[model samples]
Target: MRLSQSLIPTLKETPAEAQIASHRLMLRAGLVRQMASGIYAWLPAGLRVLNKISAIVREEQAAAGAQELLMPTIQSADLWRESGRYEAYGKEMLRITDRHERDLLYGPTNEEMITSIMRESVKSYRELPQNLYHIQWKFRDEVRPRFGVLRGREFLMKDGYGFDLDYAGALLTYKKMMLAYMRTFQRIGITAIPMRADTGQIGGDLSHEFHILAPTGESGVFYDATFEAGDPAAAADVETFYEQMTTIYAATDEKHDLAAWEKIPDERRREGRGIEVGQIFYFGKKYSESMNFTVTGHDGTKIFPEMGSYGIGVSRLAGAIIEARHDEAGIIWPDAIAPFRAAILNLRQGDAATDKICNELHEKLGADCLYDDREERAGAKFAEADLMGHPWQIIAGPRGAANGQVELKRRATGERLELSVADALAKVMS
Candidate 1:
C-alpha cells in the first residue's frame, strides 16, 4: 500500500484525553479516531492490526478444538431473563427498546444466547463436548470509558463457549483452552502469565486471566518465574502444561497470598503490573442450568451440560501489545502481528531512479510492503515509518538506487545494512 493512497492521518501531537502510552501512540500513529466518549472508528491501519490479532486468536482457538461461528451483536432480553441476569447485569448491559417496544440488548457477553442455541440444537450425550467461538464486536456501556481501546464501550472480542455432558469433559476442555491461550500469546511475541482470578460477574468456580506485563498496567501481578520457563509448543501434553502453569503460584493482587508468595525462594519470585488480554472460565452448569439447557443422558434422563467460556479481547490486544512492546521512538511491533512486514521508503520520492527501485520493491513485496510514495520530506517519512512500526524498512535514495543498493532496517533492533536491492529483498523475504 502506498502512503499517498492510504488513509492514515498521522497526528503531530497527542490528544489531551489520551492518558496512556498505547492510547497516545495509537492516536499519533493514525490507527484510530474517537467518535464519542468511549467509542472509536478503527481506521485502515488500526483495522489491519485488529485483524492480525483476530487471526492469531482464531488459529489458536481452532488448534484447541473450538469451531468458529458468528452470533448477533443484539440479543433478546428474554434470553437474559431466562438466565436470570437481565436485571442483575445493570446499566452496563446496554438494554434497548425496539420500535415495537420489544426489550433487547447490545450483548456484553453471549452466555445466554449460546446456551439457548445449544439447548435447541444439541440434544444428546453423543454430541456432548463441543466448543464454539466467534470473533465479534461487543458492547458494555462503561460509565467512564477511557484508555482508548483498552477499556472502550464497544470493542472486538473472541469469545468461546464449551459444552460438555460431564464435569470430566468440561475440565479437559478448560485445560485445552489454557494451553491454547499460552501458545497464542507466545506466537504474538508477548509473555502473558495465567493468574488465578476472580470470576466476578461471569460466575464461575474456576478462572484464569492472561495478563501481559507492562509498566502502565492496572493490575499488580505476582508469579513464579517457573511459569515463564516452559515452551508451549514443546509441551507434549496439554493437561500437563495446564497443571504446570496453574500450580506455579501466580495471582493478581486481588487473589495474592503473601504467605504462599514468600514461601518461594527469593530468586524464583517475580512481580509486575499487567494488562489483561484473555481469560478462561470453567463455570460448570452456570448458564446451562439457569437457561434449562440440557441433553439426554445415557440413562435417558435430562441433564444440564457442564459449561465454560473463554475470551480474548481482540481489539484490546492491540493496545496491550503496544503497551508491552513500544519504546520512546514509537511502537516496536513484533513481526507476527505487524500490519506490514516491510516498508519501502522512497527517501527521494520524485527522483526517477529512487521511485523505480522503490516501485520494484513494493511490487515484489506486494501486500507485505507499505511504500512511502507521498511527496513528504525525508525526516517526515522516516519518522512516520518508525511511528507506524513496520518490522522492516527498505530505504531507497537516488544515490543508493543509482548504485543498485538500498538500506534495510530491522525495526525492532534498529539494525541497518546497506546492500544491493536484491540482497535487501532476499533478507526481508527470509
Candidate 2:
C-alpha cells in the first residue's frame, strides 16, 4: 500500500478524550475514530490487524476441534427469557422494540441463543460432544465507556459454545480450550497467564481468565515466575498443559491467596497489573438446564448436556496488545499481526534512484509492504514509520540507493544495517 494513496489520518496531537496509551496512540496513528460514545469506526489499517487476529483465532479454534458458524448480532428477546436472564442481565443489554411491537436486543453474549440452537438440533447422546464458534459484533451499552476499544460498547468477539454428554466430558473440553487459548496467545506474540476467576453473571463454578501483564491494566495480579520461564503451549498434552497452568498459583487481587503466595521462593514471586483478553468457563448444565435443552441418554432418559462457553475479546485485543507492547515512539506491533510486515520509506521520495529502489522493494514485497511515497520530509517519514510500528523499515536514501544499498532498520530494537538491495529484501522476507 502506498502512503500517498492511503487513508491513514495520522495526527500530531493526541485527542483529549484518550486517557490510556492504547487509546491515545490508536487515534494519533489513525487506526480508528470515535463514531459515538463507546463506539468506533475501524479504519483500513485497524481492520487489517483485526482480521489477522481473527484468522489466528479461527485457526486455533479449528485445531482444537471447534466448528465455525456465524451468529447474528441481534437476537430475539425470547432466547434470554428461556434462560431466565432477560431481566437479570441489567441495563448493559441494548433492549430494542420493533415496529411490530416485538422485543429484541443486540446480544451482549450468545449463551442463551446457542443453548436454544442445541436444544432444537441435538436429540441424542451420539451427537454429545459438539463445539461451535463465531466471530461477530456484540453490544453491551457500557454506561461510561472509555480507554478506546478496551472499554468500548460495541466490539468484535470470538465466542464459542461446547456441549458434552456428562461432567467428565465437559472438563475434557475445557482443558482442550485452555490449551488452544495458550497456543493462540503465543502465536499472537503475547504472554497471557490463566488465572482462576469468578464466573460472575456467566454462572459457572469453574472459570479462568487469561490476562496480559501491563502496568496500565485494570486488575492487580499475582502470579508465579514459572509462567515466564517456559512456554505453556509446549506441554506434551492438554492435560499436562492444564495441570501446569492451574497449579502455577496465579490470581487477580480479589482471589489472591496470601498463604499460597508465601510458599513460593522470593525469586519465583511475580506481581503486576493484568488486562483480561479472554476467558473460559466450564458451567456444566447452567444454560442447558435453564433453557431445557435435553438429549436422549443411552437408556432413553432425558438428559441435560453439560455446556461451557469460551470468549476472546477480539477488538479489545488490538488495544490490549498496544498497551503491553508499545514504547515511547508508538505501537510496537508483533510481527505475526502487524498490518504491514515492513514499510519502505523513500527518504528522498522524488530522487530517481531512491524511487527506483523503493518501488522495486515494494513490488518484490507485494501487498505486505507499505511504501511511503508521500511528499513529506525525511524526518516526518521516519517518525510516521515508527509510529505506525511496522516490524521493519527499509530506508532508501539517494546516497544509499545510488550505491545499490538500502538501510534496514528493526523497529523494536532501533538497529539499522546497510546492506545490498537483494540482501535487504531477503532479510525482510525472512
Candidate 3:
C-alpha cells in the first residue's frame, strides 16, 4: 500500500477527547475516527489490525474444537423473555420497536439466541458437546462510553457457545477453552492473566476474565508471581494447566479475598491495573433450563444440557494491545497483528534513484508492506512511519539508493543497519 494512495489521516496533535493512550495514539496515527460517542469508523489501517486479530482468534477457536457460524446483530425480544431477561437487561440493551410494533434488541450477548438455535435443531445426547462461535458486531448502550474502544457502545466480538449433555462434558469443554484463551492472548502479543471474576448478568458458578496488565486499565487485578512465570501454551496437558491457573491466587478487585491473598508468600503476591480482553464462563444449565432447551437422555428422559459461553473482545483488543505495547513515539504493534509487517520510506520522494530502490522494495514486499511514496519532508515521513509502527522500516535515501544501499530499522528495538537493498529485503522477509 502506498501512503500517497492510502486514507491514513495522520494528525500532528492529539485529539482532546482521547483520554487514554490507545485512544490518543489511534487518532494521531490515523487508525480510527469517531462516528458517535462510543461508535467509531475503523479506517483502513485499523480494520487491518482488527481483521488480523479476528483471524488469530478464529484459528485458536477452531483448534480448540469450536466451529464458526455467524449470528445476527439484532435479536427478538421474545427470545430474551423466554430466558427471563427481557426487562432485566436494562438500558444497555438497545430495545427497538419495529414497523409492526414488535419489540427487538441489538444483542449485547447471544446466550438466549444461541440457546434457541441449538434447541430447535439439536435434540439428542449423541450430538452433544457441540461448540459454535462467531465473530461479529455487538452493541451495549453504555451510560457513559469513553476511553476509545475500551468502553465503546459498539464493537466487534468473538462469542462462542458450548453445549454438553452432562457436567463432565461441560467441564472438559471449559478446560479446552481456557487453554485456547491462553494461547490466543500469547499469539496476539499480550500477557493476559486469567483471574477469577464475577459472572454478573451472565449467571454462572464458574467464570474467568483474562486481563492484560496496564496502568490505564479499568480493573484492579491481583495475582501471584507464578501466573507470569512460564508459557501456559507449552503445557503438556490442558487439564493440568487449567488446574494450575485456577488454583493460583488471581482475582479482580471485586473477587479479591484478603485471606486467600495473604496465604501466598510475601514475595509471590502482585497487584496491578488490568484491561480485560476476554472471558470464559461455564454457566451449566443457566440458559438451557431458562429457555427450556433440552436433549433426550440415554433412558429417554428430557434433560437440559450444561452450557458455557466464551468471548474475546475483538475490537477492544486493538486498544488493549496499544495499551500494553506502545511507547512515547507511537504504537509498537505486535508483528502478529500489525497492519503491515514492513514499511518502505522514500526519504527523497521525487528523486528518480530513491524512487527506484523504494519501488523495488515495495514490489518485493508486495501486500506485506506500506510504501511511503508521498511528497512530504523526510522528517515528517520518519515521524509518521514511527507512528504507524510497522515492524520493519526500509529507508531509501538518494545517496544510499545511488550506492544500491538502504537502511533497515527494527521498530521495536530502534536498531538500524545500512545494507545493500537485496540484503535489507532478505532480512525483512526473514
Candidate 4:
C-alpha cells in the first residue's frame, strides 16, 4: 500500500484529552477515532491490527479443540430471564425493546444463550465434551468508561463455553482453556500470568484471570517471578499445562495472601500493576439449571451438564500490548501481529532513481512494503513510520539509490543494516 493512498491521519501532537500511553499513542498515530463516549471507530490502521489479533485468538482457540461460531450482537431477553439474570444484571446489561414491544439486549456475555442452544440441539452423553467460541462485539453500559479501548463500553470479546458430563469432565475442559490462553498471549509477544480470581458476574466455582504486567496499569496484581514460556513447538497438553500454572502462587487483589507473599524469597517475589485481558470460569450447572439445559446420561436419566466459560478482551489487547511493550518514541509492535510487515520510505521522492527503486521493491513485495511516496519531509516520513510501528523500514535515499543500496531498520530494536536492494529484500522476507 502507498502512503498517499492510505487513510492514516497521523497527528503532529497528542490529543489533549488522552491520558494513558496507549490512548495518546493511538490518537497521535491516527489509528482510531472516538465516535461516541466509550465507543470508537477503527480507522484503517486500527482495523488491520484488530484483525491480526483476532486471527491469532482464533488459531489458539481452534488448536485447543474449540469450534468457532458467530452469534448476533442482539439477543432476546427471555433467555436471560430463564437464567434469572435479566433483573439481576443491573444497568451494565444494555436492555432494549424493538418496535414490536419485545425485550432485546446487546449481550454483555453469552452464557444463557449458549446454554439454550445446547438444550435445543445437543441431547445425549455421547457428545459429552463440546467447546464453542465466537469473536463478537459486546456492549456493557459502563458508568465511567475510560482508558481508551481498555475499558470501552462496546468492545470485541472472544467468549467460549464448554459442556461436559460431570465434575471431572468439566475440570478437563477448564484445563484446556487455561493452556489455550497461555499460548494465545505468548503468540502476541506478551507474558500473561494466570492468577486465581473471583468469578464476580460469571458465577463459577473455579476461575482464573490472565493479567499482563505493566507499570501504567489500572489494578494491582501479585505473581510468582518464575514464568516459563509455553513451548509453541511441542504438542500442548492442556491438562498438564493448566495444573502446572495453577499450582504457582499467583493472585490479584481479591485473592492476595500476606503470608504467601512473605514465604517466597525476596528475589522470587514480584509485585506490580497489571491489566486483565483473559478470564476462565468453571460454573457447574449455573446456567444449565436455570435454563434447564439437560442431556440424558448413559442410563437414560435427564441430567444438567457441567459447564465453563472463557473470555478474552480482543479489543482491549490492542491498548494493553502498547502499554506493555512501547517506549518513548511510539508503539513497539510485535512482528507476529503487525499491520504491515515493512515500510518503504523514499527519502527524495522527486529523484527519479529513488522513486524507481522504491516502486520496484514495492512490486516485489506487496502488502509487506508500504511505499511512502507522499511528498513529505524526511523527518515526517521517519516519524510517521515509527509512530505507525511496522516491524521493518526500508529507506531509499538519493545517496543509497545512486549506489544501488538501501537501508533496512528494525523498529523494535533501533538497528539499521546497509545493503543492496536485493539483500534488503531478502533480509525483510527472511
Candidate 5:
C-alpha cells in the first residue's frame, strides 16, 4: 500500500484521553479512532493487524480440533434466561427490546447461545465430543471503559465451546485448549503464562487465565522462572504439560499464595505485572444442566454433557502486544503479526533514482510492503515508519539508489545495513 494513497492519519501529539502506552501509540499511529465513550472504529492499518492475529488464532484452534462456526453479535434474551443468567449478568449486558416488544441483547459472551445450539442438534452420546468456535464482535457496556481497546466496551473475541460425554473427556479437551493457547501466543511473538484463576461469573471450579507480562498491566503477578525456560508447545504429552502448568506457582495478585511463593528458590522466583489476554474454563455441566442440554447415554438414560468455554480477547491482544513490546520510539511489532512485512521509504520522494528503487522494491514485495511515497521529509517518514512498527524498513535515498544499494533497517534492534536491492528484498522476504 502506498502511503500517499493510504488513510493513515498519524498524529504528532498524543491524545489526552489515552493513559496507557498502547492507547497513546495506537491513536498517534492512526490505527484506530474513538467512536464513542467505549467504542472505536478500527482503521485500515489496525484492521490488518487484527486480521493477522485472528488468522493465527484460527489456525491454532483448528489444529487443536475445534471447528469454525460464526455466531451472531446479537442474541435473543431467551437463551440467557434458559441458562438462568439473564438477570444475574448485571448491567454490563446491553439489554434491548425490539418494536415487537421482544427482549434481546448484544451478547457479552456466547455460552448460552452455543449451549442452546448443541442442545437442539446433539441427542446421542455418539456425537458427544464436539468443539466449535467463532471470531466475532462482543459488547459488554463497560461503565468506565479506558486504556483504548484493552478496556473497550465493544471488541472482537474468539470464543469456543467444547462438549464431551463425561468428566474425563472434558478434562482432556481443556488440556488440549491450554496447549493450543500457548502455541497461539508463542506464534504471535509473546510469552503468556497460564495461572490458576477464579471462574467468577463464568461459574467453573477449574479456570486458568493467560497473561502477558508488561509494566503497565492491571494485575500484579507472581510466577516461576521455569515458565520462560521452555516452550509449552514442545511438550508431546498434553496431560503432562497441563499438570506442569497447573502445578507451577503462578497467580495474579488477588490469588497469590505467600506460602507457595516462599517455597520456591530465590533465584527461581519471578514477579511482575500481567495483562490478561485469554482464559479457559472447564465448567462441566454449568451451562448444559441449567439449559437442559441432554444426550442419550449408551443405556438410554439422559446425561448432561460436560462442557467448557475458551476465550481470547482478539482486539485486546493488539493493545496488549504493544504494551509488552514497544520501546521509546514506538511499537516494536513482532514479525509474525506486523501489519506489513516492511516499509519501503523513498527518502527522496520524487528523485528519479530513489523513486525507481523504492517502486521496484514495493512491487517485488507485493502487498506485504508499505511504500512511503508521500511528500514528506525523510525524518518525518522515518518517524512514521517507526511509529507504525513495521518489522523492517527499506530506505532508498538518491545516494544509495544511484549506487544500486538500499539501506535495510531492522525495527526491533535498530540495525541498519546498506545492501544491494536484491539482497535487501531477499532478507526481508526471508
Candidate 6:
C-alpha cells in the first residue's frame, strides 16, 4: 500500500511510559494506540501480525485433530455457578449484569461453557476422545496491568479442550496437544520450552507451561540442554514422544529443586528468565465432575469424562516475541508474521528515476509491499523502516537509480547488497 494512504503515524521520540523495547518500538512505529490504562487499540499494521499468528495457531490445531469454532466474549454466569467457580474465581473474572439484573461476565476462560456443551451433546463413551478449540477475546481484571499488551486486561486467547473416556485415554490426548503446541510455536519462529508449572486456580494435577526465554521475563525457568536441541514434534508415537520430551528436568520458579539443580552437571544446567506463552493442563474430571458432565462408561456404569485444557496467549506473544528477539535498534519480527515482508523506500522521492524503480518493485511484489512514497528525508525514511521492522529494505536512491542499480539491506543481519533493479526485485521475491 502507498505510505500516504496508510495510517502509518511514525513517531520521532519514544513514549515515556514504555520501559521495554517492544512496547516503545510498537508506539514509535504507530502499530497500536493506548485506549486506556490496560487496553490498546490494534492498528492496521498490528492487526495484520496478530492475524498471521492466529492463522498459524488455527492451522496447527486443526492438523492435530482439533475442530475450530469461535466463542463469544460475554457469557452467562450460570455456567460458572454449575462448575462451582462463580464466586471462587474472585476478582480476576470481570463480572457484569444486564438490564434484567441477571449476572453476566466477560469470560476469562471457557472451561465451564465447554463442559456445559459436552454434558448436553456428548452423552456416551462412543463420542469420547474429542477436541474443540476457539480463538476469542478474554478479559481478566488485573488490579495493576502493565507491560503493554504483555499483561493486558482484555486480550485474545486460543483455548482448546479435550475429552477422553479414561485416564489413559486422556493422557494420549494431552500428548497430541503437546506435540501440536511444539509444531505451532516452531512455525512462528519461536523456541518455547515446555516446563512443569503450577496449575494455579485451574486445579490440575498435571500441567506444563511453554515459555520463551527472555532476559526481562516474569518467570525464572530452569531446564536441561536436551530440550534446546530436541524436536518434540517428530515423535512416531505421540504419547511416548511426549513422555520423552518431558523426561528431562524442567520446572518453574516455585518448583525449582535445589537438589535437582545441583545434581545436573555444570555443562547441562541452564537457568534463565522466560515468558509464558502457552499452557496445557490435564485436569481429569475436575470441571466435568463439578458441572455433572457424566456419561455411560465402557462397563455400562456412569462416569465423568477425563478432560484437558490447552491455551496459548495469542496476543501476549507479540510483545513476548519482541522481548526475546529485538535489539537496541527496534523489533526484529520473525519473517512469517511481519506486517510487510519488505518496505520499498523511494529515496529521492518525487524524482522520476526513483519513482520508476520503486513502483516497478511494488507492482511485482503485489499487495504486501509497503511503498514509502512519502517525500521525506533519507534519515527519516531509514528510521521509520527500522522501527517498523520490515524483513528487507529496498532503497531506490538517486545515485543507484542513475546507474540502473538499487540497494537491498537485510534487516535481521546488517548486510547490504547493491544490484540491478531486476536482480534486487528477483532476490526479494524469491
State the C-alpha lDDT per candidate: 0.91, 0.93, 0.92, 0.89, 0.94, 0.89
Sum up the clashes in candidate 1.
0
Candidate 6 per-residue lDDT over residues 153-209, each given as its tens digit: 988899999999889988988989999999889889889999888788787899999
Q: RMSD, each candidate, Å? A: 1.0, 0.8, 1.2, 1.4, 0.9, 1.5
Model 6, position 401, has a per-residue lDDT of 93
Model 1 RMSD in Å is: 1.0
Clashing pairs in 6: none
Scanning candidate 5 in windows of ten residues, the lowest lDDT window is 228-237
What TM-score, over all chains together, does every model reach? 0.98, 0.99, 0.98, 0.97, 0.99, 0.96
Cα displacement (Å) at residue 203, model 5: 0.8
lDDT of model 3, residue 179 = 94
Residues 1-430 of candidate 1 have per-residue lDDT tens digits of 9889999999888789999999999999999999998899999888989888888888988888899999999999999999889999888999899999999999999999999989999999998789999999999999999899999999999999999988999999999999998999899888889999889888989999999999989999998998778799899898788878877899999999999999999999998999999999999999998888888999999989999999999899999999998888799898888888898988886789998899899989998689999888889888999998999999999989899999999999999999998999999999
What does the lDDT come to for candidate 3?
Answer: 0.92
RMSD of candidate 4 to true structure, Å? 1.4
- Which pairs of residues clash in candidate 1, taking residues 3 or more apart in a chain or in different chains? none
What tens-digit string does per-residue lDDT give for candidate 2 at 120-194?
A: 899999997999999999999899999999999999999999999999999999999999998999999999999
Model 2: residues with Cα > 4 Å off, grouped in runs: none
Regions of model 4 farther than 4 Å from truth: 228-236
Q: Cα deviation in Å at residue 227, candidate 3?
A: 2.2
lDDT of 2: 0.93
Off by over 4 Å in 6: none
Could you tell me which residue pairs clash in candidate 5? none
| TM-score, structure 4 vs. true | 0.97
On a 0 to 100 scale, what is the lDDT of residue 339 in model 3? Answer: 91
Q: For candidate 2, give the lDDT of residue 312.
A: 98
